[model samples]
Target: MFEQFTQDARQTVVLAQSAARRLGHHYIGTEHLLLGLLSQPHTLAARLLVVRGLDLAYAETTVLRLLGTPGLDARDADALGTIGIDLSAIKEKVEATFGRGALDRDPAHTRAGRFAGGGHIPFTKRAKKVLELSLREALRLKHKHIADGHLLLGLLREGEGLAAKVLAEAGIDFAQLRADLDRDIPAVPA
Candidate 1:
């Protein structure tokens, strides 16, 4: 399936892995893929996303805010907040005492999924589905290869991943974004 990916599409996948690592996440999810798309500022996906206020920095912050650092979850914070416990403040003090990344869970201690070896983070099922949908999107559009735009289309179509959540948070209209992409996708075959 990757054989049909254009260089830009391949780069997006690589960037997704980088995003996951940078976020201290053990698995590559749709949120990381969305950050990957935004990282490539020159790509059609990035351009469109930026126009809608979903730049890489904003996306990265949103992903971290929602997903939290490794070993932590945003929901945990919310739960703590309800109980008058400030997780963020506690984390800050803990990290200050033990150095940064002290709260991060060791990979070996976490559930082992499909590790790609050499510290390669595995993709979440939904992320893999996004890639598959990218192929389907290319075929649907009568294109020969998958491109970054197709990846974005796939993310939007998936609609249940964290990437979609970020889009929703930004108030981006899925149908309008897809229509805009469809209007512009033909100009670039890759």
Candidate 2:
């Protein structure tokens, strides 16, 4: 599904995959995507998340705690298995938001190769949808740049996703966050 993606969208997917590997996660989750966005410095998505009071260190700690990994360990696999984050649901939401064109081409014809010496874990349907919505929102706003804030807003709109749940757990009020985003985000030029 990488073929349909524009360069930026593809980059997001690549980043997400890298994050999953770095975290030693077998599945691609929304939190991983969030982290992926955070990994990019100066991206609007990262800046927006910062504005929402999502401290990088805190978020990292939370994610590690959720994964039962206070420190990175090979034995944490069992603990990680117990905490499942649904990617398919996220992909569905992404499709609804961004459409199918945001992904890469199907890999049916290509040789199934390992990724980073690990198995391949494609973005869940919900993640793809979230990405789609993020891209579309960026375009609609005429921002010409896709930022971390836009991704955060997309997660807020996703409503029922794990990312939203995490935000809620962190005491992030969606409405207030949106309002703040509106106030903080620069207006698109006419």
Best by TM-score: 1
- Kindly list the per-residue Cα lDDT of model 1 for residues 17-109, writing each as its tens digit: 877765556688999889889989999999999999888888877876776576557788898899999998988898687544446746463
- The estimated TM-scores of all candidates read 0.80, 0.58
Cα lDDT of model 2 by residue, 1-190, tens digit:
3443444445666677777665545556677677777676566556666766785566666775565533335445445545773444544576566443112222341234343335677777677677677666666666665555566666777776556666776787788877775565544422
Question: Lowest summed-lDDT stretch of 10 residues in model 2?
Answer: 101-110
What is the Å distance of residue 182 in model 2 from its true position? Answer: 4.1
Those runs of model 2 whose alpha carbons end farther than 4 Å from true positions after fitting are 1-11, 67-113, 116-120, 139-145, 182-190
Q: lDDT for every model? A: 0.83, 0.60
